[model samples]
Target: MAESTTVDIESQQAELDTYHDEPGDRPVLRARFEHNGSPRYMLYTIKRLGLDHEHGFHLDVQLVSDSLEGGVETVEAKLQEGDADLIDIDYISTARERADGAPIVAIHPYGRTVGGLVTPEDSPIEDLTDLRGRRIGVVRRLDKNWILVRAACRERHGFDPDEEATPVEAGSKVELTRMLRDGEVEGVLQFWPIVPEITETGPYREVLPMAELVQDLSETDRKLPISTFLTSEQYLSENPDAVRGFKGAYRDAVDRLTSDDELWEDIGERLMYEDDPEIVRAVRDGWREMVVADWDAETIDGMDRLFDHLLEVAGADALGVDHVPDDMFRLEV
Candidate 1:
């Protein structure tokens, strides 16, 4: 709500974090989240709550890996190997991972998205129907979204992405947009976060809300995939303060972020690839769709629906279990 003068990031973090670089009495919680917007929220929390000079422990978030591709997996491995404390549940909480009987659990409700599919602005395609017999540019990986796209194609049009249409993968969003802008692909299926930038900055149009597409194809009532902080059962037990502190700070950020135009503008100017007003507004609106207050009954229900859809395509063995564990959401010690 108020203006915050830009300061040295390292010093600001140290001043805001209860657990500074110097080891403190408060347990240091080493964590990594998809830097997409998660870190921005955390940083906002530090500023909003004046946590920079607060006394307590620290939640050290490694924001080096900007995308989830490398960061989430690296954190998941570290947590499983006992080198890190927290990571996203999507990384390791698959049915198969749960079936393995590992003690990982969703420690905090971070954010959620229903996502979207976009296409080139000049393309003749107007809706999902046009996607039939066309090539689409996607991310570098066969993410869950891609899996759902395959399902949607098979059910809606009897056209399989693998056989009837081409789904090309590029290294990053920039590369993907490059291909699309250069007329290499007819359409692009991407998530919500980068879609705004794609439409506002690049040559594209946001079409086919992906959550609706996935829901139509999968018949899932609540099409939501939660982005949460997950931790080993042992770690939660060991460092209760770190867990609670991080959660409180995160909630503080989300609670205030939506209405804080100044913060949003500042964040946009600092983080976005381009600093245009339209792009900032679009990105902020996209982030707005991702924020939530709690993992209430409805939220968890949405996760179950999504998990079921994933299970059908990815299978129990591939997902690592036969069911979604109830203990995935833990609010306290």
Candidate 2:
């Protein structure tokens, strides 16, 4: 099944490559995304509906490898090195990089890209208090989901999970899932996209979604976006129209994805790691609530408040940055 999915992704990449073979007079906006990530669903829609062209640009999509590969060449690396024009990253990481002099700025929000704490259905653990001494698997100690979990635990439960329980860093999402299935960990903080598959197909349950924690910590009545669309400062300054065009294309694609149920059927066959009907339905529904349809000054303020809360509870070291740069967010684009 995995082999077939890989082949399908490769075939899709080949097809997308042909779309911009000529480039013509349109400015080609090069972008990179994880090979099987959720963003591709919207990107596929944009290309299929000719939203990019209609908005005045040519979309050049690059499917990137997920492996750290010694952490040399990544989506962020491509953007910093001027090899690509756009990518999405969690805002905390963006702040850290910006503090260290990376010329990237967030142009738009990508939604609350949170994960959940998953345990086997029959497991005795029912809440954060039950995680006292059990092993929890995470992609990394510094991952945003784990940080949020720690903050929520400390604030609501009166103990830091980092000190009270054992955390096993699995190095990657795939390995984290394997650790849970193999009984290497009692609970795993898994990303949202992979959560439905485990809970739907097996005896697993999400104890809590980190999104709830984000809302509670930020004191917001509505969901706030944790990740954002990013591009180099130079790219935004030089090609302002292209950046705005991509935003229009993105908004249109999101609208179509939200309203068209049949379009999800195509996404399940083409972009998803698993094509199970239940999984597809779960993903489609989740995307509707998680993707930010639009953002205004209030949205940015909500994010700022969320950042302040995380900083206050988690500390600068835990967040990897002491402060958010003044120019970190640019909604003007």
Candidate 3:
């Protein structure tokens, strides 16, 4: 028999550390969100929110940055495919294609939606009807704000958008926006990265705020879900402790950023690392003014009303889902 060398001992230790036997010691929870500034900042800040998550587990928030390559639906598809524990997206109650028959539900709401219709400065478009027959930009189902535009066009102009409008799909946000800027598309019906908050406001002008448009079209003043955290029924059942820990820390982090402006800016910079500081500042200012830390009663009521509007847009035979998924939200840890 021979004694092992120092390098050999260290190698063995590294191997032993690779996996943990205890659930609390080294569990990793994978949460997914799109590759944009808001979710980006939230994930980055949540990572540094300090202390341990439930059962001593740590969260590994996945940034689905393939918006340009794979398209926006890729992130939601990942969740539907059972590849993640949680997802970051808007809580739009649409019986969307990929989500059919899936028990995917919204767990928490974090921020307001930033989607808007941006058009060229010199464009002649003035109303939703003007977009008819012209090529319009869309990110497919991921652009949750499209329901507003569709409802407006259908009710106000007496035209069916799905049939009347020429929708140009570019898969990714970058491409969708490029088409709009190059005049390849006449209008961009999108939000988040394409919104004026996180992007430059010089070359484009906002034709409609998604919230206002949805309100006008639906003929109701109830608020709609802008952003939310989602998870599956199985994940919640299997990882109750971890889920609670993550949610608790998340709500705490939400409250913290609202109170601490410096922390918000610092985290905002990291969240928008790819953005210009000026743009980030403008976004941060707006974010500070509206970032939601909790889902209250009025908020929940607004969401319920949103479902009603979605039903109106989708119709009985279409995609309107009445509830935000059966008992999906947990108000406390």
Candidate 4:
């Protein structure tokens, strides 16, 4: 495949007078990311850092417009075959295990959850047990929400996902939401933001939150890993200052995301621009449930368990704990 046109930090900055910042003093950070349907909040954060043209640091973001599976394969190929300077990927658990020689820098966390229950009046599908015999529409079989939901059903509700519930796969969120509105599915399994968005649009009864089920089955400290950021190991060693600056900027973005309610509303609106106003509100509400943190021991361990479980489900070899580097969760400067 032909390589995309490269954007040089100094040259790009020099072209724009207003964006110009001291280039020599700042380090440049190059990154590539997968376009996972949702407008990524991290990208917004990166933009907010003003590193796009800063002198001491420059940040370049690229969008992988391919299928998620294809994107993953491309990322793995780039890491295994070439000498790329920077890479930022979604769903770090998979990348961390397969990165080979690349050093990874930690970033914010996000996870999957079942849609929030919306009711004309309150109903009994109050917990995982109530899901049996019900129809559930999912965006994709391999999506993280489906995995998390399957785990909850098996571990907590004692229900076999294939046996207990009807599973309908939709190609997009809009299609899935339409199914729910039409009474085609009793529940919808999706990530955080979409659940609330669907509920606000009406026709659905309620969102059966998967996180609450996980909490009930597991401990309060336990949480599932949905996604994270990473770069190559070789890049980190060669550009420690750049890595630090990126981390610092990222953490600042996380703080801003977690603290600002209006920002989330704006994000929801931006992401759900094609949807109805009610849908945007629902999306915002669902997104609010997501918790972002710098990966800690508990989070890392939780991800390890999640990967093991996923491997078991897929009937594949499990990734060893040693596969995750000591610095996998390192967020501190």
Candidate 5:
């Protein structure tokens, strides 16, 4: 594939408008990511520190919005349309898309970035069992978190939330948080960064971190990668060096995120939606462990087992793919 054309980060999205600016001779990897998400913390670090250039590539960061008309497209749409070179998505969603012949591949793991079941502080719902016959808010019924909840409920409590309780699809993450805050739902499964914002600022608390269930179901002591860095097969085959450069930069970014306290403070001030010191600390502490810098054969084995478990519990309809494609994961680059 040809070197991806760089978009002026300042002209693309106003929420987070900055880039490395110095491309030099490195190939450009256009990354379409969600605004104010956890991935931005690393992307920002890469741009701020010029990690991409150091690793022999230029990181051209593009922010995607929930809607397409926001000047930039959604991550999946941008990637599939070939408007962007790469993006990060949950592996399960990547499986579903690839099964539908989207031709995307998971290049590396992004660690266990799944959110937990959060409930209001005063609610009587203590555990997954208590969620029975209650309204639960989610981004969508088919979201990985909701499916995990369903599978865990069935496997652990012998009850399926989908069948026993009403799942209100709030349509988006913002609305999901609002649903829980307004008492529209007894509990909500919101993503990280946002979860800390909700739990730390008000009368909400995490009932369970989904990572525990991921460990229980995968039956691995390791925190396997749920979300992964993805790219098109064309991009990977044509620009192998660019992909390798990205992986190296990503590893460095993860290292910095792990040991850098001052960087978190900078992120809190500039990148975070809620910049409260407590929320910033919560996000930093919770996020550092969720990022997997690298993966190997053993890690792939655990991911395979996790996929089988999801297939067994969530079923094809909920998973959106009957089976994971053979070429879905391409870590070689």
Candidate 6:
């Protein structure tokens, strides 16, 4: 893994050339990600696909310890100006809205699921309605889960998250888990893969899952978009072969993740800090529980709904989904 930094276009092209070992060899693909967050998951998935070796790709995973706000800003700055073959990020909608001219390669889809710190014996908060007047800890106001939770609360629960409950912002997952463990918040609306680790640490309860709640409310299939792989339009135009190769490798990773339980167990142990085997098992189980699909009509519509909610929360102009180019999501096969 190499460090990600600003590079001139020529130098970046030379870096891509390294993926090509011999004359007329396949170009090496370089993917960049902000080290600690969802993008890291994407990087690992690519690795599992064996893309680095298969296509002579280089994975450049950089750890930037900024909170959500700063992280997004850093991502935007890099995509708009930095020199990397590709950049992976969560919240594709936000990235696309900010970097309008970027070429995005949607390697795979990440469905949204929720978990909270609650005891098993506690009354199951099966839906957002049950969360009324309860304090909730969130990673950030703009987090996709927060957006979905707010929508669910408004439409299904008939309660406004802004008006009904107190919201505390935690700097990171560790801080958020601490808030839950110390009884600072009644529940925490977090993505599925993360909840298991938080619960294993203390005597917390399991509430309703975000994915189930969304299905109940919409009466149609939907999953919140968590992340995607993206690059500048220029990069994609210059290195179409590399993009295709990377996409193939990523899809391979998704297949492995979808089918192999042992692989996920290994991933859980490597990614999560909690040593409890139960937690690791729970995380693996949770990953299998959610949907992972390509960007289809239903998924896009779901994203539209999410972006609409985001606009309401941020009081900004609605994101134009029509602007998302047809080639945004790549089917590696």
Instruction: Report the lDDT tens digits of candidate 5 across residue range 1-333.
Output: 111212322333443446547677888899888764589888888888888888999888877564333222278888998999989888888888888888899998887989988998989999888987899998887678998988888788888788899999876676688788889999999987788889888999999999888899998898899999999999998999999999998999898899999999988887776789999999999898788989988988888888899889878877777787887888687
lDDT of 2 by residue, 19-133 (tens): 5545578888898976755677888888878888999988889887543434422677788888889888789889988898999999988888888899999999898889899
What does candidate 6's lDDT look like per residue over 1-333, in tens digits?
122222322333343333333323556455544433443444565554546557544444444432444444345455555545666455435445545554545554555534443433364555566666778887765555565666666665567675677778875555676677777887787656666655566566567566665454445564555565666666667777676666666556656776787766665555544546787677656665553645665666665565455455433322233244455654442
The TM-score, computed over Cα atoms with residue i paired to residue i, of candidate 3 is: 0.78
The lDDT, on a scale of 0 to 1, for candidate 3 is: 0.61
- For model 2 the local lDDT of residue 277 reads 96
Candidate 1 runs further than 4 Å off: 1-23, 35-39, 51-55, 66-75, 81-83, 89-103, 171-175, 214-225, 309-322
* Reference-based TM-score of each model: 0.77, 0.94, 0.78, 0.65, 0.92, 0.71
Model 6 residue runs over 4 Å out of place are 1-42, 45-49, 63-66, 69-92, 99-108, 113-127, 222-226, 291-302, 305-333
Ranking by lDDT: 2, 5, 3, 1, 6, 4
Candidates in order have lDDT scores of 0.60, 0.84, 0.61, 0.52, 0.82, 0.55
Model 2 lDDT on a 0 to 1 scale: 0.84
CA RMSD of each candidate after superposition: 5.7, 2.2, 8.9, 7.0, 5.0, 7.0
Q: What is the lDDT of residue 149 in candidate 2?
A: 83
RMSD of 3: 8.9
lDDT of 4 by residue, 1-333 (tens): 112212322222222323334456456665554333332555454564574343245766544432224324344445434434444333534444454444455544544333443433344566666767877777656554565566666665666675677778765555666676777777777545655444554544555666675454344465654555555656667777776676566666656766676766655444343346566555545444554545676776776665555445432321222244455655553
2 versus 3: better TM-score goes to: 2
What is the C-alpha lDDT profile of model 1 across 1-333, one tens digit per residue? 011212323333433353334545667777654334334445545544645325355656553232233423445556677777867645224433545666787866655544567776677888656776788887543444556666566555666566666778764444566677788888776657677767877667887766676456445554344567778888888877777776776666776677787777766655555568887787677666666556666667666776676667545543445687667666554
lDDT of 3 by residue, 1-333 (tens): 012223432432233233323345655677766654365555555566542353256776555543533343666677777788777666653234224576776667766665677787777888777877878888764356666677667667788676777778766665676687677988887665446532474577777767676456444554445667777777777877777777777767766666676775565444443346566566666666546666776777676666567667655333344445545555554
Q: Which candidate should be chosen as best, given TM-score against the real structure?
A: 2
What are the runs in model 5 whose C-alpha is more than 4 Å off? 1-16, 67-73
Which stretches of model 4 miss by more than 4 angstroms?
1-39, 49-56, 62-67, 70-126, 171-175, 178-186, 222-225, 261-271, 274-289, 305-333
